[model samples]
Target: MNEILNNLLSLHSESEIAEFKEARNSFDFNKLGKYFSALSNEANLKKLKCAWLVFGVKDNRTVVGSQFRTNLQDLQSLKKEIADKTTSRLTFVDIHEIEHPDGRVLLFEIPAAPQGLPIAWDGHYYGRDGESLGPLNLEEIERIRRQNRASDWSAVTLPSASITDLEPAAIEQARENFFQKNPKLVQEAKQWDIATFLNKAKLTINGQITRAAILLLGKAESSHFLNPASATITWILKDRDGLERDYQHFGCPLLLGVDEVFHKIRPLKYRYMKEGTLFPEEVEQYDPYIIREALNNAIAHQDYELGGKITLVEFEDGRLCFSNVGQFIPGSVESVIQTDAPESRYRNRFLIDAMVNLNMIDTIGSGIRKMFLIQKKRFFPLPEYDLKDNRVQVTVIGRVVDMAYARKLAEYPNLTLEDILLLDRVQKRKPLTDDQAKYLKSLGLIEGRKPNFHISAQIANHSGERMQYIHNRALDDQYYKELILAYLEKFGTAKRVDINGLVLDKLPNVLDETQKYNKVKNLLQALKQKGLIESEGKSWRMSKKI
Candidate 1:
């Protein structure tokens, strides 16, 4: 702390990497997060290791003391508050308090943004311009992101590693996958020795083991050759309450370990109606290809440099989460789905190519898109990607999330996968951009306003979900008025509360309480205007003319 204080004192002026404020009583939590993003980005741009946010210091470097976040608990809560809103849940690296004869000073150390990824607060990139905190300029955001175009880490050769470090069993599996992907090489593959086979399979460079070979085919103990890089995958099974039921960890020679991990997962039977058929078809809860693709992608993209092992977790409730460390190369899954070819840059080019040559993953950049399509074919929820914490987490749901939505999908085989994916988002109540919403609206495939959308009546009715269709559809105003009139006639009179009690629950559950109330109010106004009923003080009654 003394050394850091001296370093700041040496600067003697607020710059891009340092900000000073006299926060004697308190400071805005959101503003603190903005500073976190701004300072972190500024540090990255300035090529500094850390940025500082000092409280209790004047612009002129005078220490007046700070009562800001004086309570230790409140001060700690700031970490969670800031992390929850920032990209990758980034928060202060450390918070230090030093008591001086003049006053107590708080120093917040913020780590620089990761290479190629800028820090963002609540979706907006932030940076410091001189000493002012604000949105990161377009040029700066691009500058940081461009760093991703650097050389791939996995492609680098391991100087001392050799074929001896690779397990024979893993090499055999790799050979089989290689031949399976390239059947023309079957006869030739059988004749090649281990060294020749590895070179032919792209797993080795001139008989010397590359990082890719060590990662995928190295013996478990030989993982140390990658020093500080983790070559392990952890699979855990959890109950509904999130209690772990079982867990198994697999080490290097992931070529064989991936299969072991797959074997541990118990994908039970899930029965759903076959498209256009009344009879149900029983299929495995998870598609085999989908599982392999997800796992292989994790292995191929794992940021070994980050020293975090891949994790795959299965829940009793029928969902699988595959997680690996590193920024998602494309940044968003949508980008991957929309792109015409493989990503131009990868964290592990050699490893990914090896996986591709082994038929472990598709090299055409269609793996994620294919996973979504397979889930869609099964009438299951689309795979979800949660990109944060310098990691990518993918969740594949086994069961149908919305039966009505799934049934609609089955009934409309003509709908494109993209359309089905967009509709799935609607059914799940996830937000859609204006362009997506507009496209669906134009096709009459979805209705209601932006953000709160439902399957269009045309689709619902065609799909044989007339009930859901009717529920979402608003009936003629006259019909609700008739219900109000009938209630009035039955009891001779009724209060507004009584009328609401009779009709609110009967209204579509999709409408919120406020919308339900508004519907009931509209009905009453319609009835009164038509002279069928009149307000009798707080009560409503049939008109005497009736």
Candidate 2:
């Protein structure tokens, strides 16, 4: 520790991966977190094992002493506090308190941000411009993220773990699935031994059990084989209010754990009236294939080295959210959906290969696109992917929000998947980019202004949702101008609040409260510009010209 501290002190100034802070008193917790993110990212960028955040050191290499977290217990507790806000809950590797001759120096050892995953503080990525801390640029973030493209953690063989650590039942299931995936191999596969089958299946490297093998086939007690890494999937049932109702944790073998988690979810019967049917059509709230595909994807892509369990949250309102700790390698969900080709890169090539051979996942990269297609076919909202916070969370909505919109999806068999996705965004009240809005408008598929767009009137009328269309559709600017003019004519004067009451509710429901408020303000401004109405303090009245 002394030698390490001496080396850092010998530096002329702080570098990208080494930062010196002089905290003669206490340091701000938020600022400390920012430093943690910056140093961790710099370490990854510089290909260093770890970075240094040394306290009690001035910028000039002077040890002034630090009173930050003086108490031993409080100092240790800083780990959890930093983890709570950092990406993947990453914290200090070790905090060494060295009593230097000059003062009490503290050395914070920060591990490099994991491959393909950049550390973020409080939802933002931070980095150091030499010694100065700043937001990590996109290129740097992508550079750190691309580091995992060539590496496969699951491909690494476990030296101490063997086939004995695997569960017989899981192995049997693996054989069955493998044979099912390759019917021609069924006869020959039966003759092969467990090791031979595992080797052939790519679950083992030269008959040595790999991390992928342990995760899919290892016995529950054999989880320790992947030290500092976890192979557990947690399923939680939540009510409408987001409170947990029940929860269960499943450890490897993850093949069966996927099933256990699936069964735990209650996919209720969802009944909805078809366009012209008297009796409602009933379907399962969630599709079995969708559930398995999502769960398997989570397991396959999870950054196990982060030591976090895959999470499956089932909401009573007919939604399933599957989350795993890792960056989405494909970058954007749209790229995967739009492109028909398979992904050129994968984070866990061996695990994905094993899963593919075991009939768990497909390598075609169409799994996510298939999820979206399945939801569209079932008249459900497209699967939503939240790829923020260095994690991938996919939410599958099992029920339809709009019957008309859903029927329209089935009605227009030629409607492209991209079109349906854009319409799905509209139905979900999600904001659209100008290009998306313009494309939808050019096709006459959507109506209304920006951010307040709704389904086109033709579709609404055809689907018998004219009332909903009218509610979402905005009135003409002239119509709103007339309402304001009539109000001021009858009342002589109207306050901004009074004007809001007159036209706010009349505005389209598609516009949110803020948009609605902005609409009213714009109307007042337009009328005032045309010399139709004038503002008097906070009130409005008919203009002298009018």
Candidate 3:
């Protein structure tokens, strides 16, 4: 019932917060309780909000049609059974029934264990070790217990930090940015001194310089105040081969360092002719706001405690990459886009607040989505975020990868940003959810099965992909069978190889040779079933009556 179920179903295999089971006909009730405990505890340790136990699916994630607890009342009763045995009377948050094309699916939403408390079933604590259920080990139990007690690294005050430790120019810039964001405060901002300005901008808390203050406004040499936590941003230029061509590093007063980094990379003008326009439009290689927002985001969200510096790489082509050392506080980029609100938790709460107050970044959580939208408007590839190994890496492309497809998507004003995003995946030949594939197919905007789709003629003409569409298009099976019949009538007898050779090139180019051969095989079977053709040994011939 939850939208997250769609994302989970798209997962190729079980995860710490998710499990799949066939459960066809029925399943043991106690096994469900054990899984509930395992998933809930695993979710907490992994810093996830909830876990899932999916029924009607196998270990390989195949939907084999589950019949477990078919009766609504019986399904409802299982909740009480689980609660009676769990450590905190914890049962499923909700049991959702989804009607999937393959079969009926049951999704059990299990809330993560409360902070500092490990979930248990019948007095035995449980957790997921990879994909298998097991006891919550002492180390893992302690990890969950320590989650809430962990201190905020960015909020700590540096005793030796003072107003002199901050760069005067950086402070002036912060004030100017603040005024620009709040034009009404112009005269009032001029009246206040440095201390008042710092406090008002949320850079310093009660005149005590915080780690955030030193990181953003402190002088270059003042970085030692946040010892072991590097207040550095590195910019590197790479050639086409990905070899480092040049590099520059900036430290402290990140407010100014952000600009220094921006200056190091060039944003050249690029020209492109639109599909329907006679004239060409010229735009900057990279949008300035996007560049600033990306750099500021890296500074605001970097895990400085890790002692790793934020890195920006500019490719010789037209791409920029920004990476910060830390797990994305929101867990997933999808959560950031879908929530569209300030996150409840942040790795650098104080730094983020200060940056927002200084107008360095937006606080409404729409910044990332806005970045995606801006690129979409420019008819360029959407920004790609790769979050893994406790790091968040984002890549922004300046030019269009497929000009026609990008233009087609840009011209469609009625399409929602989300729809455009999914369509972008279709154009790139990426995997799609079954529901997504079905919706696009119904609109005649896409063709082919999941994971291997092509833009359909309905939208391809506008995208300048009409020829591509024709090449990818599939004709009716009856037509292919008719072609086979005609071929046999002329040749009298033909080997399987001959039939394959005759039809392979006619099949959609989107399909591989194996798929093309398979298509011919299916057409041959259909012809034999209709008695229009008969196979003798390895060859096929027209039926005597026909």
lDDT of 2 at 442: 92
| Collision count for each candidate, in order | 1, 0, 0
Could you tell me which 10 consecutive residues in candidate 1 have the lowest summed lDDT? 271-280
Residue range 235-283, candidate 3, lDDT tens digits: 9999889999999899988999999999888859878865556224888
lDDT of 3: 0.83
Best by lDDT: 2
Model 3: runs farther than 4 Å from truth? 1-150, 278-280, 461-464, 475-546
Residue pairs with backbone atoms closer than 3 Å in model 1 (clashes): 88-389
RMSD (Å) per prediction = 5.3, 4.0, 16.2
Report the lDDT tens digits of candidate 2 across residue range 113-219.
98878999999999999888999999999998777876889999988888899999999999999999999989999999999999999999998899999999999
In candidate 2, the residue pairs with backbone N, CA or C atoms under 3 Å apart (3 or more residues apart, or in different chains) clash, namely: none
Candidate 3 positional error at 256, Å? 0.6
* TM-score to native of every candidate shown: 0.74, 0.86, 0.65
Compared with the true structure, all predictions reach lDDT values of 0.84, 0.90, 0.83
The TM-score, computed over Cα atoms with residue i paired to residue i, of candidate 3 is: 0.65
Best of the two (2, 3) by TM-score: 2
